[model samples]
Target chain A: MTQTFEIAVIGATGTVGETLVQILEELAFPVGTLYLLAGSNSAGASVPFRGKNVRVREVDEFDFSKAQLAFFAAGPAVTLGFAPRATAAGCAVIDLSGALPAEQAPPVVPEANAHVLEGLQKPFQVSSPSPSATNLAVVLAPLRGLVDIQRVSVTANLAVSALGREAVSELARQTAELLNVRPLEPAFFDRQMAFNLLAQVGKPDAKGHTDLEKRLIHELRAVLDTPALKVSATCVQAPVFFGDSLTVSLQLAAPVDLAAVNRALEAAPGIELVEEGDYPTAVGDAVGQDVVYAGRIRAGVDDPAELNMWLTSDNVRKGAALNAVQLAQLLIKRLV
Target chain B: MTQTFEIAVIGATGTVGETLVQILEELAFPVGTLYLLAGSNSAGASVPFRGKNVRVREVDEFDFSKAQLAFFAAGPAVTLGFAPRATAAGCAVIDLSGALPAEQAPPVVPEANAHVLEGLQKPFQVSSPSPSATNLAVVLAPLRGLVDIQRVSVTANLAVSALGREAVSELARQTAELLNVRPLEPAFFDRQMAFNLLAQVGKPDAKGHTDLEKRLIHELRAVLDTPALKVSATCVQAPVFFGDSLTVSLQLAAPVDLAAVNRALEAAPGIELVEEGDYPTAVGDAVGQDVVYAGRIRAGVDDPAELNMWLTSDNVRKGAALNAVQLAQLLIKRLV
Candidate 1:
């Protein structure tokens, strides 16, 4: 007999939160009771779960102690404040935001860093990797053991949904406006994003790197556990809606055979390898899937020791929601 | 007083050719007589030159001997057949196609390699640098003397206009359709380009590298005269209508100071340097401009020897039409 757990999903009406509810049912997670909670504006809304409408409760009024496991897909401010309260109330929390848990729980990509959760149980606060870092970690995890990775250079093409549902709606409206030759005003992004590529994703830090780029590097180092890993990232906001794409170049410590690398990527978990003659596209291949779809893999022509490839995944599904769901499943298994 | 020359513009009805005609007038080129020629299909159509409409003549029916200078902005096959015929008929040819000249004339980016055109006269044949190579050559030419560039890695984000007018129209149509929830069918590009980035540009060679990538490597070496300069290029088609963007990384033989690199880029001809805080964007800064706008220049975190930057330019203006006009001006100067 399976033991069912009471679950709470914060920000349940948002993009990732709604997906998380659907993914829970799709994955057939045994749930005794499901509670959907959102901000006051979205509190009265109804969201579907398991073919039934679940009424969203106001997060401010909900008690954290009611649920055994709580998934926080809320924004940073909400996660920073309420996550602590939820954890103190004896509920396990899986943060999808790239925030450090109050308990300083290790950031985990279950397929990449499952060893970290070997003995963890309920009442522990942990993090599911950010959609950006999760995809990169999944691809780089297998290669770390195959050969020492000296350095990595990533050019991530992020979609609008990485911002939020407002960004998606803005893109749609702005695109329509532009098509009808109406003037555009940027609201969500600081620049025009419709039918255009914006090199700046998040705001820049003191060193001139955007927050998104810096986060990718910091998280990859901790998740990969290569304390001195050299990472260079350039994040661009592509004119896409659902998927995140990356052009990654890896400098290996030793020269690895191309055929061997190909074999390893093909067999790697949480990734699907599309070799030459079939490149992986964002909308066509990655938007609905949980796997990291990768292609255009090659040994760098300038240096055989370097490997380059294109990686894409559903930033909403694999990057955030599915990654969180997968982590929750891993945590649930160790609950007993 | 400016001396005038008889000019023939092949492919007069096409996108770049139209831009070429407008730019020639905008820059006040000395044109005694302008002959507009296209395929048989566009024979009776009229194109505007100097506020006057000139009837488009069938390319086959026009006599190449009548014009003193011929600008072949036509497709490669048309250029291959007609350019040689025009050259044989005692007319000088300026090719924008970037193919090796049929008469083995040197390819030139006038701003960077104008010295190559020193004593060349009328009836001589030459090729203009492709828009890709022109901007890169202009930026790299000045730096070659200051620092020895050992290797270059470029990720070019190209616009639909790079493909042609049909592509621009398709992007416009597809974007409008997508906004209205209408179905889409790919025409010019094999993938959906409404709000997506395509990893593939040109057809792949036997080694899985696309022809566009190989051409960038070859032309950069030839134009910069860095014979052994190693280049790894990945060309991605972005979903914009008019501008081109590139993320470039350069490995130098010796470490160079950041201040010196900034000075060289700023002083370089036909390029405007944007500093760290303010970066140049493709759509915002590059369209309708002759300058290659570049910014985000920085050193690699792992190795300061590696320099990276963002480059953008008007693909039609600087990338094609203006580069050709500049070359023709150089050729005309030599003739006088």
Candidate 2:
């Protein structure tokens, strides 16, 4: 008989949380009972699942110990306050937000570091990964092990949905307004994010790098577990909705050819290669896809030591929901 | 007093031609008489100029020698056949297309190469510079002299306006169709050109690089006279209607810091630096502007020998119209 576990989805009304619930049902994650919890804003909202409408309950009133596992997709503030509570109630937590404290609980991209998660014994354990970093790290992990990466330069064309649902709707609304010859009113972003690319994504920290850029640096290092890897990234807020596209240039310690890199990517799991005519695009090919679609593979013009590629992934799926679900599944397999 | 010249604008009904005429009026180029010539399709169309409508005349019937200067804004096929005829008829030609014969007539960015136009002696001479290459070359010329640029990798996010007027309207129409939940019809471009990015702009050659990429390589070499400079580019057809944005990463022979890069950019002509808390964007800053806005200056993480920058320019203005007008002005001064 297949044993089932009780599960709870915090912030059930958000996009990532909804996607997490869907993936659980789609993957048939052996759920005995499901509780969808939210704050007053989305408390009464009804989410359909398994041929039934489950109304959202207040997260404050819901008993955390009732569910053996909890997936937190709330914002940083909510996750900060409630994640510890859920853990104290003896629930293993898989957090989609990167706002976890530096408490050494282990930030994980399951594909990259699944070895560490095989024999965990701690009850109520919690871990998180940066959404943007999760996608990049999964793609880089296999390559990092194969090639001695000397330096890496990344230009990430991130979609508005990377921000949240509001930003995606804002793009559609602003684009409509502009198309009708009406003035665009900016909200949720500093400048017009529709039909325009913004160089800055988040607020700047002390080093003149945007907070998003700095986060990518820290999180990529943590996910790849390479403390000294040299990486630089330019985060651009592109005028798309659901996916993040990255142009990655890697400088290796030794020279390599197209065949070797192709071998590396093909061997790596959770990545789909698009090699033929018309490379993958965010709007056209990457939406609703679990695997990162990588294409436009070319060697550096200057030397054989470097390689360049284009990567597109649905940031909502692989970047957040699927990674979280995979980590949750790993947590289950670790139970002794 | 300013000396007047008789000028004809080929392809007078197109976007580049309309912009060129407006710029001539805005910059007050000394014109004795203007002839707006188009093909059979736009023969009777009237373009507004100097507060009145100027009817488009048939290019086949018009005498090329009647005007001393001919600006070939038409497609390459027309220019290929007519440019030599205009030159043979003693009309000086400023061909914007890069398909000119391989003989070394100065391919100029006036700011970087005004010295080459000082003593021209060919009576029916023609010169050309690719629009995309002109923007990139103007920015790189200053840095090429300062730093030993080992290699450059560029990601150009080009707008539909670069393709011409029909592509612009296609974006509008496709966006409306997509917003209304209707299927998109790809007419001018191979794929849907609304809210999507295409990796290939021109036809791909044998080496998998697009024709546009080949042009950038050839023209940048001709503009900077750096035959050995290593350069590679990926041209993306972005959803924006105007202004092209570029992300350029340069690997130098020696280490440099933020202050040095800032100093070089500050000293460069025809450049505007956007610093701290704000950066230049294609939409908010570049449209209708004559200056190339360069900002988001960052150095490499692991090595100080590398630098990255964000560049945006009005492709119609500095890329085509203003550069052509400036060259015409240069030719006028060279007449003595």
Question: DockQ for all models, in order?
Answer: 0.50, 0.47
Q: What's the lDDT for all of these models?
A: 0.82, 0.79
Candidate 2 lDDT over A186-245, as tens digits, reads 887777777788876876554457767766877788778888877777888888877888
TM-score of chain B of 1: 0.96
> Candidate 1, residue B266: CA error in Å?
2.8
Candidate 1 local Cα displacement, residue A205, angstroms: 1.3
Question: B1-336 in candidate 1: lDDT tens per residue?
Answer: 779999999989888999999999998999999999999988899988888999999999889989889999887778887988888898889887766542376667876878877746557777776677777888888787787786677778888888888899999988888777898888877778888878778777655677667667767777777767867777888888888888777877777677888899888899999977778888788899989988877776556677877788988889888888988887887656
The DockQ leader among the candidates is 1
TM-score each candidate: 0.93, 0.91
lDDT of 1 by residue, A1-336 (tens): 989999999989988999999999999998889999988999999999888899999988989999989999988777887888888899998887767642376788877887877756557777877777889999888876687887777788899998889999888878888888899988877777887777677766655677677678877887888768877778888889889888887877777677777788888999999968779889888998989998888776657777778889999899989888888888888775
- Show the colliding residue pairs in model 1: A131-A319
Off by over 4 Å in 2: A60-63, A88-90, A101-105, A119-128, A142-148, A252-256, A263-267, A301-305, B58-63, B101-103, B119-128, B144-147, B301-303
Clashes of each: 1, 0
Local lDDT at B246 for model 2: 85
What's the CA error at residue B47 for candidate 1, in Å? 1.6
Chain A vs. true chain A, TM-score per model, equals 0.96, 0.95
